[model samples]
Target: MRIVEDLRAELGDRIVTEPQVLQAMRTDRSGWVGPGTPAVLVRAASVADVQAVMRLASVHRVPVVPRGAGTGLAGGAIGTEGAIVLDLSGMRRVLEVDVQNEVAVVEPGIVTDDLAAVLAEHELWWPPDPASRAISTVGGNIATNAGGLLCAKYGVTRESVLGLRVVLADGTLIGVGRRTVKGVAGYDLTALMVGSEGTLGVVVEATLKLRRISRDPVVTIGATFPDVIAAAAAAAAITASGLRPAALELMDAATCTAIDDLLQPSAEYPVLAGRGAFLLVRTDSAAAADEAALAARLIRHAGGEPEVSTDALTGERLMQVRRSAHPAYARLGEVLIEDVAVPRSALPAMFAATERIGASHGIPIPTIAHAGDGNLHPNLVVPPHLAGEPGHIPDVVWSAADELFHEAIALGGTLTGEHGVGILKRRWLADELGGDVFALSERLKAAFDPLNILNPGKVL
Candidate 1:
């Protein structure tokens, strides 16, 4: 490209046009190939590098897709044809950790766990614990408004964000939100940008809210029920009992069996061994032991064998398995993870519908969930041979997914709970948001990015 040559000449090796680099930067972790490889990969070293790339892209009318660690599962960071993959992973820097203000300033490229580690040194922590914290960037977490094991109690990334430094599509840099805790200054543009999927603007840096770690509870509880519905019943009971557990997770038989098999047999992994459906509950309040005891008795009353533990190490190992649910599903085969959420009271009905869907489709769909919040991840696994066949793979999986998504909607639930509606779920956005709201969302997108060059086909 003659237009790209100028960028190459000016940026030197910073602007990558090599085929291998382009190929390597093409897709995200969505398990699907992009429509086409990127034309150039810009390893942005600073905010200025990003602004220069955006400026050039705006002038030439080329698409620009902002990317962090590419650990996204929704294809939000995947590059489009002839687009510039603006890689921000090179800009990692923790600028400041303000204990007095309970905030930390850092570049977008910093890994989520790294920021948590830094805050831990100051006796403070950020609680959003996405399973991919080791590999996912804070920018990507903010982009998707990620949730994790502890999110039901601690809140998601959007709740923890204080401010953002974003580069608009036309190369304009601006700050949104505030460093302080309270402010109703305007229309909450910072919240708007938090989950825009890089379609609105490129996030360069962020001011993150932190919290002091609590050691009150020092106890964890585990239980196994006859099935997912029974486990969900126990979860609903726990929630109804007014016992505020910090984390509440659920795993079905298949998910637990696979995780148990992958980890091999061990005494510490009994939470996953021979458990048809399991629930993990943790509390950090002063009533920790009481909460665990009450929760355990409720699980028993709900027809489950309760496994109570004050041993932190054993509980941590079990929680690690819950965190590894998605990865364990990946080991099965080609998978499409469905992020569906229903009312807590309707979880049993949701599981019944899921079972019916699996039975009807003849697809082995393993489910794991943040049961406390009623968010379930139903993983559709396709065999290797079927994946290569024409139409069989997506045809089967998508048909089942359509049924499952509609079931969620029918139950007064949502298409996605934690995962944003990226490429994979864009077609269903209108169905979820309805005509008027979805149309307003389109207007919002146009207002932020008129040319639709930022993350071209994601979200609205």
Candidate 2:
């Protein structure tokens, strides 16, 4: 209560204590509610506002949850009980675009797609295009080190982010990283903060590296296999063949069915017609045509039906089917979206393992993958009765997720590929990182946040 009073006094009308607003900030798209309601929400409009919030929060010893567009799939941005929800969505601004230097300086709250649009005007591109780019903010993407269909070739948010201006727990402002393409001056704190999920500090501004938009025509190849394993194998083969596609996506049979059901009566794009599994590959390099032709031939060799097209509309339509996977699953019930990554060569085995896990659990785990990078998004469909119940995840679903996480680790992969270890996956982080590394990480956290006032109960 005193902290709330202090925040209101310091921030004037910017601080919100309304019950409805607090309730809305309690959780994110992950649907996992925080333990308690946030004491206040501070809509930070600028870096100064962010600094003020962190400074007061440090003095009051209040937990500060830094939030962006709230499009995060993990519970990283969820507002916990008695904490100060520092909302940065209002700070959306593209400060500078250095086309000659191929870099952009932007405020954290700028939408990812909006930044892309601005960059597009200059024939420049930001490669980290998450599925939620339309709504997700650049800050959130940097916080999660997000990856997308293009990650296999272009890399994730960490790769695009060259530098950051962050506000620490004690209200200290610091900048990390370099503007140039190559610099190893000091510790890679910028890289660390990219996926730190706001635990290390609050990112207020970022300098992002940019790439030239490929002018070559895109060639898309759509293929259907007898089953998910075969399709995954084909994807692996494509990667092994050393053909780098701009995007390589895979959807399991259930995912295809769900997409088709969601987009019903669309005669143009029937998602495999209840076939087995689907793969969408797009190449946009100078040799896109040749690469796509070779990829199509490989798909055919792998017992798949291949469809090749050079039309941009057709490519987008095909990619749309892949993008619709999450929404389609959401239509079924409350979904526990799982993210895992494994070695490219082990993709088929991982798919087989997922199938086995789903069958053993007796639940439908419709999966989609950025196949080129071996990152799989398995949607665990919760029963309809439990749908929309805040803070609820069935025991069975957690059990299945536990098994899936272990399987990924066993296969020499990670519990999360793009998504950070928010509250959802923090339980198993130590298991993957091992005790020594995990302890070191804890020390680092303590060094950055001695009082533990920043994003408490997250990513330790």
Candidate 3:
């Protein structure tokens, strides 16, 4: 209560104590709700506003939950009870664009896709495009160190981030990283903050490295296989053969079916209809045509029927199917999205494991993958009766997720690929990181946030 008064006094009308607003902020897209209601929500309009909130929170020893567009799928941006919801979505501004240097300075709240559109005018591009780019913010992507369809070639958000201007737990503003193309000056604190998920500090600004938009003709290859295993194998083969595609995505039989069903009678090309599994590949380099042809050969070798196209609209339509996987699943019932990744060579095994786990659990785990990088998003569709509330996940679902997480770990993979270890996956983080390393991570977290006031009860 005292913290709320302090926040209101410092922030004036920017402070929101309305119960409805607080309730709306209690959960992110993760479907995992916080245990209690947020004490207040602050619509931060600038870096100074963020600093004010954090400074007051530190003085009161109150928890501060930094939030972007609330598109996080790992509960990283969820607001907790007695915590200040530091909403940064309003601070959407592009401060500077150094086109000569191929770098841009931007506010954290700028939408990923919006930034891309702005960059396009300059003939530049930022390639870390998550499926939720239309709504997800740059800050949220940086918080999770997000990867997307093109990650196999361009890498994740961290690779493009040259530097960060962060507000520490004590509200001290500090800048980390460099703008130079090459610098090995000190510890990579910018890298450390990239995936810290708001546990270390609040990211107010980022200096991002940009690339010139490719002018080469784009080639898209759509392939169908007997099953997910075959499609995953084809993807693995393409990766092994050193063919770098701008994007490589795989959708299992169930995912294809769901997307097909969603795009019914008026659908122009029903390529996904009755398909067992589908692979969407795109190559946009100088040798895109040659690379796509070789990729098609690999697909054929893997027992798949491949269709290659150079039409940009056709390519976008195919990509639309891949991007529509989650919404199609959500139409069925309550959806629990799971992010797990394995080595490229182990993709088939992981797909096989999902089949077995889904059968054992008696739940349909419709999966899609950024196959080029071996990251799979398995959607657990829980019927209305079983899925009671928005944030409530049944015990059986958790059991299945536990088995899936262990399976990934067994295959020399990780519990999460792009999504950070928010409340949803924090339980298994120790299993993946081991005891000693996990303990050291906690110590490092303490060194940055001694009061444990930054995103408490999250990411260790």
Candidate 4:
């Protein structure tokens, strides 16, 4: 397209049209499958630059795929065949911090953790922290309406957003939502942008609500069981007890082994080799008696051995091990990460079905979960050497996971809880949402992007 020629001249050598550049940006952390090359890559600096690119794409009838740090696990930032990748990573900035109002306005490329660090200096906190917070951008989180460990109490990204500045497909910039505590706003476009997955418009900036930073003492609880089903049962029971914990996580035997190898833990029994899966639950309070007693009762009822920890450093160390799961699994093989979620009661069945799927396919699928919120991550380890063949173990494991994905939908659950449905889950989206719902979503997409030049073939 001649638009590529215009972008090259406008953005100078920063605009990359080379084959290798296209290849690198076309895939994300999910690694579901490689994607087709984008015709051009425009690394935008200022909002004006973004406006220029959007205007050109609109005029030329070219697709524009908006991208942040490329840390997305669901391929949300991936480009389509012969499209323009509007890379927003260069626009990182803290535009404004209204400390009095308890809000911060930032550009889309600002990392979640970085924003948290800045907020920490002011004794403030932004609570929507996904696992990839250190690398993922605020815009990506807004697109997916991400949920995280604290979601059981704090809610997801949707509840935190107060205002948004979105650039529509036709290059119209509209501000939505109010900065004040509450308002009966018009259609609530700010709410609509959350979890839209870039199909509607580009999120240029956001004003997010903040909470007071706390230094409360934390109590950690560790519970082990012979299988994932028992642990899931314990998780559900703990939530049912009404004692909300800071974090409720589960790690399978394989994952524990991976963590042990990576951190070289000196525990008497390796974290994984304790004979089964374990639950790591944390509460951000010094009053551990209530939380600890509830956890113990639930764990025992679910057929688990429970241990409550009051030591801060020891609990922190164990939480570190839990957070290291993804990187450790990456070292073992090519990772096929599934972010499927089911009802709280359906978790035990989901775990059982996952184990059966692995065994049936002769593939070992180690699992983990943010159990408090019923978000399950079943990582399928694919050995690099065996990649690309139809008979590869990774491919087999992925097929099994696909079956589980459909099963979750059948049980009135979603294919993804936190991770957005990028190209990886595009085919099954209709199956989950159905024909009429899908058509309504498409009509909304058309209303916002009449030219159909924004992140084509992603969620529709």
User: What TM-score quantifies how close candidate 4 is to the native fold?
Assistant: 0.94
Candidate rank order under lDDT: 3, 2, 1, 4
Residue pairs in collision within model 4:
none
> What does the lDDT read for residue 143 in candidate 3?
96
lDDT (10s digit) by residue, model 3, range 1-460 = 8998878888899999989999988888877888899899999998899999888888999999999988888898899888899999998899988899999999999999999989989999887989888899999999999998889999999999999999999999999999998899989999999999999999999999999987899999899999889999999999999988989999999988889788772555555867889999999988999999999999999999999999998898887777788778878788789999999999999999999999999888999999999999988877566878778989888889999999999999999999888889999999999999999999999999999999988887
Clashing pairs in 3: none
Question: Which scores higher on lDDT, 1 or 4?
Answer: 1
Error of 4 at 148 (Å): 2.1
Candidate 2 lowest-lDDT run of ten = 265-274
lDDT of each: 0.85, 0.90, 0.91, 0.83
Residue 232, model 2: Cα distance from true site in angstroms: 0.3
TM per candidate comes to 0.97, 0.98, 0.99, 0.94
* Better model by lDDT: candidate 2 vs candidate 4: 2
Each prediction's RMSD over C-alphas, in Å, is 1.6, 1.1, 1.0, 2.3
For candidate 3, the TM-score is 0.99
Arrange candidates by TM-score, descending. Answer: 3, 2, 1, 4
Q: Write the per-residue lDDT of candidate 4 for residues 1-460, one digit (tens) a residue.
A: 6998888777787688888889887787776544477899988888777888888899899999999988888878888788899998877799888888899999999998999989998899888978788898999889889987677668889999998888888888888998988998588888998998888888888999998876776778888898878888899888877878888898877877787787776763335564478898888766666777778888999899988888877787777777788888887767778888888778888888888888887666788888888888988766456666421335576688788898888777889998988877888889998899999999999999998998888878
For candidate 2, the TM-score is 0.98
Cα deviation of 81, candidate 3, in Å: 1.1
Whole-model lDDT, model 1: 0.85
lDDT of 2 at 270: 54
